[model samples]
Target: MSRGSTLAEKIIGRAAGHAVQPGDLAVVAVGMAMSVDSIAPSVIKVMREEFRIPKVADPEKVALFVDHVAPACNVSTAEGQAEVRRFAAEQGIRHLYDVGTGVCHQLMIDRGLARAGEVVLGSDSHSTAYGAIGAFGTGMGATDIALAFATGKTWLRVPETMKVELTGQLPAGVMSKDAILHLIGRLGIDGATYRAVEFYGAEDLTAASRITLCSMTTELGAKAGMIAFPQERLAEFGLPEWLFADPDAGYVHAETIDLAALSPQVSSPDDVDNVSSVDAVVGIHIDQVFLGTCTNGRLEDIHAAARILKGRRVAPHVRMIIIPASDDILKQSVADGSLISLLEAGATVSTPGCGPCIGRHQGVLAAGEACFSTANRNFRGRMGSPEADIYLGSPLTAAATALEGKIADPRNYL
Candidate 1:
């Protein structure tokens, strides 16, 4: 007489006032719906055609952001943003954010738009980033987003749950990003397909660490990602404490990853799951070092890199770029002197946006050049030209590589 476990199940169970079991088809009410400029216009189009409505069911519950193409790169992007702005105004939406606000995922959490235990749907893949703060947030396509806007509800088949318990303390210089890369390496790309990954055990769940871990679940092909919150952690965000899971709660699958022996791990070019330790790739030539993204762009991540690059100048032939996740984080870095250290060490500090991570607007590489990035995804041409090579690693490794003008281990400097 036990209920099945899944992320969609848990959200539907709480939203529908009934305990939902896996494999069940359910219509779940949502607490919030969000979209960025990249996909908001398409969702708006779908809403106009499908619902024939100029407004959403609840405008206040919807959020639109211009973070994806902030500062408006070209005429096309600018027009897209203008359309989103016009739609928000026409629909009377109140939570719309313009440029300079920050990235959508960080802005959503920082602005208190996501509440604990509520179902939130976003149009961006990184929507799972909100799960770090205890909200059940996930991504969908434009059509699904439009339906959610029209009805404040969406249909989902409850997926199974996978329990990932982390035991043992993370060694110094090893971060949550490294931990996740380690998991991807072990599980392969299809490891958690159509399942929810729940992180439990040991380390206190900090906002930064949770974001780092959950943001990369896409690499494992997870449908949704989550972590349990301790009471103190909830209070930090001024939210009510909620129960995560009972001691007797069951999971479809359970696995534990021991991090005591883990070193800095890197997902090599062309494959996210193709992981190797820092020692394996040591001395590889690197042309660039990038430190920013929703995953590793927090103040703590920046400080970790700064600690390693404090007085050392970047290699003359290497290009190092630092982009904070938000304007607030950028300001904090300036106040804490991390910005100065980065600049003094010959690293370029870019605006608070996802630059060079997506290879869209900034830091595209030349043929055969190599880069070590803190962003997620290491697929071919992810950061720039298809011919350019990219490597994914923690901020610490990226910074050390910038110093040596190649892939060097941080322990070398320590």
Candidate 2:
């Protein structure tokens, strides 16, 4: 059988300065290593023990953020932040984003910490977001990340590629998150395990939406996620154009999806791949609506929600919240009118942070209460009490649900 070129293969190939073949072992070099407060301390301990070095290879190469425990909700979280602060100072890492910065992924991309064709790894699964900028990025465990910190290298088993050909325009009110959810429904949660997904054939996606799509590949258990570099898209980042694949590039698996017919899809509570269209449960009531996360918390996502909620108020029974991905996004939204629109609609706007996504500091849900959110994970008790129900969707769907106080099809409002 002929071998296929996966995105991971291509990236590892370039990083190792060799043409990577399928099943070949490669030692790839990464350009950046990032961690959030939840995982940074553990990685620091591993670096100290395994590397046997008092400090990291390059402190600036490690970017740390406190977004996971932002605003220091309690004494324990405050202590965690203290530990991160002391470690950063001791390691001399200058790119630390403290309480005010935002979600680590958004900050990294917004500040140009990630560049095209470079290998970037993070302790958070949504690290795949950098693929939107034509970079090869993925998430790893804290121990693996710590090893990368010590040696500036990591071993990878080149994975097979899966080509997801997205044809046709997305339906009105349907965004990339819905599209990905629909895919998960068809492929199941473990379908892409240890493989790379390369999205192609959709030419109309904005750079922000493309990143949102790639970021969720982690939910499918993909090794990494990437998109071909369209010149116009690359230009948005002021990045140089690069070829993602040759015309005849091979793929182990290929599937074509016509997105024009897809509806606003939702992943059921607790299981990411248990997807159903909004039509499947049209009148389901929800207690909260959350719009923000590494996946869909970018400026464009907020603008999309604001357009839908501009003249309306959220349903009286629902508590709506909007969290921007970063402080810069928050500042821009304030200047651009989206923030005011959200507030006018009776929605609370939070500072840039992971917030309710991690279930630690903000927007914890009561038992049996349901929420529609834009965050990536919806595991059991991810947002609060074990009995709370969490539905995952795009920011557009989340906003519409807030207005309707139920699982809603955003097309009605759009």
* RMSD (Å) of each candidate, 1 decimal: 2.0, 1.9
Q: What is the lDDT of residue 154 in candidate 1?
A: 85
Segments of candidate 1 deviating more than 4 angstroms:
3-8, 202-205, 230-242
Model 2 global lDDT (CA atoms, 0 to 1): 0.84
Best by TM-score: 2
lDDT over C-alpha atoms for residue 49 of model 1: 83
- Candidate 1's clash total is 0
**What's the TM for model 1?**
0.95
Q: What residue runs in model 2 are displaced by over 4 Å at the alpha carbon?
A: 1-6, 230-242
Q: Tell me the tens digit of each residue's lDDT in model 2 across 308-361.
A: 899899999999988899998999999999989999999998878998997886
Residue 29 accuracy (lDDT) in model 2: 84
Judged by lDDT, which candidate is best?
Answer: 2
Q: Model 1, 1-414: lDDT tens per residue?
A: 774344445565887678877677778888889998888989999999877866699998899988776777789989999999998888899898887667788878888887767888899877877767777778899999999998899888777778888888878878888889999999998899877788875336457888888888878888778875544556765554543554555688887888778899988889899998989999899998999888798898889899999998999998898888888999999999998999999999777777777777668787899989998887888777899889999998888899999898887776
